[model samples]
Target: MECARKDRDLEAEQALWQRWQARRDAQTRAELFDFYAAWSRVLAGHYHARYPHPLAEYADFVGLASMGLLQAIDGFNPALGSRFKSYAEPFIKGAVLKGLACYIKDHQQTSRERLLSVAGEAEEGDDLATIVNLTVGLAFGYFLELGILDAELYDNDPASLYERENGLETLAYLVEQLTEGERRVITGHYYQQLSFVQLSEMMGVSKARVSQLHGQGLQKLRRLYEQVS
Candidate 1:
């Protein structure tokens, strides 16, 4: 009886995937998302439990995991003969890690900015020197924190290193396939952490243009990812 029930559930899920893939049915996709919502949250909770960030709440991880879950749903290939959960786990984890990385980076940048602001406002002589020293100490601390976090996130095992290298190579290949404008926007925004406003100023284009390029670039990347997957 239990086996029969499980089979029925699997059949229902397979039907949903077929409808979404064939027709890009919005309702089917939404249903799939709702069905897997709890699973996404469980994955998020697992990561949060392992690596709790002071600045990031559990809800934040859940939100990031949802983005990953959506990507998984969109990119998943039923023809690949792999279970959806198996394929989606990596995407979901990657999204959470990427979000955590961005959060830490932003926090570090903010700390540096605050330090610089303090140094700029400090009185000349001993006060200025003290502020500079404090800034240096804080910067060093942030650097160490990043190093430790990275080490914790990525294991030193051979399999892990190989997987990381392969993932980077795949990403590089995908980036290379982008148009010049899209390439610039994607690289500058992601790698350089430049905002659309900053990219606009640097590229001598309007912010709207930068945003459009960014959207186009991401769309292309998504298609490329699906192809490769």
Candidate 2:
């Protein structure tokens, strides 16, 4: 009974969105923004917490997220068996990274060069900034070269015989080997889509410590990923 009711509710929401998308008027777009701006805030906050680029503007990310949310709402088909957050978050996150290069190019030449240069270095034995730089550079329609973030992007068929070979499947297993704090840091940061500031508050740790734990968690996932691969 509960499941059926939930399905009905989802369908109703989908129908409403479809109507809004069809209208394509300024008022409808404003309504859409009002509905989804909170999601934009969550995604922007999440990336901001993780990537505190000193020379880059954070508002660029926030604006991109709102734009992404609008795109997601306009393009989404709720019948596709994907949640709005799952479908929209990627769009939001991608826009932020791509926009970063443009923002950096105008604001800081040295930092832009530094960010681009980090792409070739291996994830291990590198600073968290390197991983972050790689993430932003490669996240737009390209595969992430590192562990957790890369693994998160590969969508595999559930029943496929080669599912075990999926990087995300492999990373999921590696996550089980992590310590509780590490698991919390990675899962909370990636899966829950929480900001480091929010995660820090939740865990009663400093924001710096949240970043440290995130880096540490990635290190462990990297080692385990190597062993399995």
lDDT by residue for model 2 over 83-142, one digit each (tens)? 887888888888777766565435243233223433434546888877775665434212
Cα-based TM-score, every candidate: 0.45, 0.39
Clashes counted in candidate 2 amount to: 0
The whole-model C-alpha lDDT of candidate 2 against the native structure comes to: 0.60
Task: Give the local distance difference test score of model 1.
Answer: 0.67
Which pairs of residues collide in candidate 2?
A: none
Residue range 1-229, candidate 1, lDDT tens digits: 9999999989999999888888775456656866786688788889999878887866567767877887798898898899999999999999889889877424454343334432333455666668766565445323322322121336789988877666666766887899977777666544433456555655567876766676566556656866896
Best by lDDT: 1
> Distance from true position, residue 187, model 1, in Å?
34
Worst 10 residues of 2 by lDDT: 138-147
